[model samples]
Target: MKTTILPLAALGIALAVPGHAAAKSGDVQFKLLGTLVAPDGKITSVKKDLIGLPAGTQTKADDNVVPTVAIEYFLTDAISVETIAGVTQHDVDGRGALAGAGLVSNAKIVPATLTLKYHFGKDGGIQPYVGAGPSYYIFIDEKPGATAVALGATRQKMNDKVGAALQAGIDVPINDKGLALSVDVKRYFLRTTAHWYAGPTEVLTTRHKLDPWVISAGAAFRF
Candidate 1:
């Protein structure tokens, strides 16, 4: 009689389990997102010229729109590891004295970030999360623009950078089929060194602080 009762109790418990519990432990999530990267930092020229030019010539980078993707593996219901990748292009121009001179240079950046996230939620409801991690950026196709060419700048190059990344976002379940809509904002503290030929004989060097905020929104799938 005890064995018959035990089996019935197990069956009832299984039937009462919520379907959203499928994302509980050891789940992997994939997201395809669109991102806007807006630069919010300054660029300063470090090497002062012999002609006694200003000590810190400043510049600003323009904002960009790009496509991004992220993959997350849940270590537990509240903890996960995520990696995000995206490619973006930006136009850099001078400020202050060189302002309105048009584009100084253009560069394509591919950034990959790995983060550990902490999420707050129960099974299938809205999940809000925060993450922090490190990001690696590869700068490619650094080319001189019209302004740079007019200033006799040639062979421009931007150094690759590694920086800290911070993120915050929420995931709202759209249906019971392991699908959710996600929105997140991330900031990166990135700095890089720039080298270019001011002329056929002169090489100009500077350091740029390219702290950018990335806002993303998209759909995610949990399995």
Candidate 2:
């Protein structure tokens, strides 16, 4: 799990940034990135298992690639704030004792995040940055997989949760026209509960680790 703390840390960064903010002050940068979402959906505990799950059952979420957009505003040449928008989908399958079992299907996630970054170098050169902030994972349109359906699971739900994120990346300038190539990676620490229901009755409940790595690379436009 990421110990990056919470979103409130963004409030304290102004006092820590170096005094060289005049060059890129008030600048805005827009980026269109191709992102990869890789998550670990391993079951941590089975709170309720009415369906008689076998011993040592585990789960793993699949990876996904999607298009994402990032918008950033520079408070100074060295410090900036950013947010991203995108949707990712995944599927969880059984492992260990539950090998070959399908657990969840087409789970969509909206990783709502905000970060405060500190760029390392001055303008007209390659710059590296590190950031941290809060994250809210919104789950949507999740359905039970074939194995669960066969075992009498009529519906499924994954709860929304608040978490933290840590990020590190770099930006390389292409020219003097505010064009750049950027690469970024973020790791989010999150946990949530999964519930399975049969018509009007709740049948099972489990806790899962949802730590995900988000990697992105693409063109950036700064003005």
Winning model by TM-score: 2
Candidate 2, which segments miss by more than 4 Å at Cα?
1-23
Which pairs clash inside model 1?
Answer: none
- Against the true structure, candidate 1 has what lDDT? 0.80
Q: Which digits, one per residue and each the tens of the lDDT, describe model 2 over residues 1-223?
A: 2346544355344223333222388999999999999999999999997888888899999999999999999997788999999999999899999887888999999999999999886444467899999999999999999999999999999999999999999887766677778999999999999999999888999999989999999998888
Whole-model lDDT values for every prediction: 0.80, 0.88
Top lDDT model:
2
lDDT of 2 at 41: 96
Candidate 1, residues 1-223: lDDT per residue as tens digits?
9999999878655433246553566999999999999985376546534323344456888899888999999998789999988889988876777775544456899988999999986565678899999999899898877876766666778889899999999987777778888999999999988766665554566787888999999999988
As a whole number from 0 to 100, the lDDT of residue 177 in candidate 1 is 76
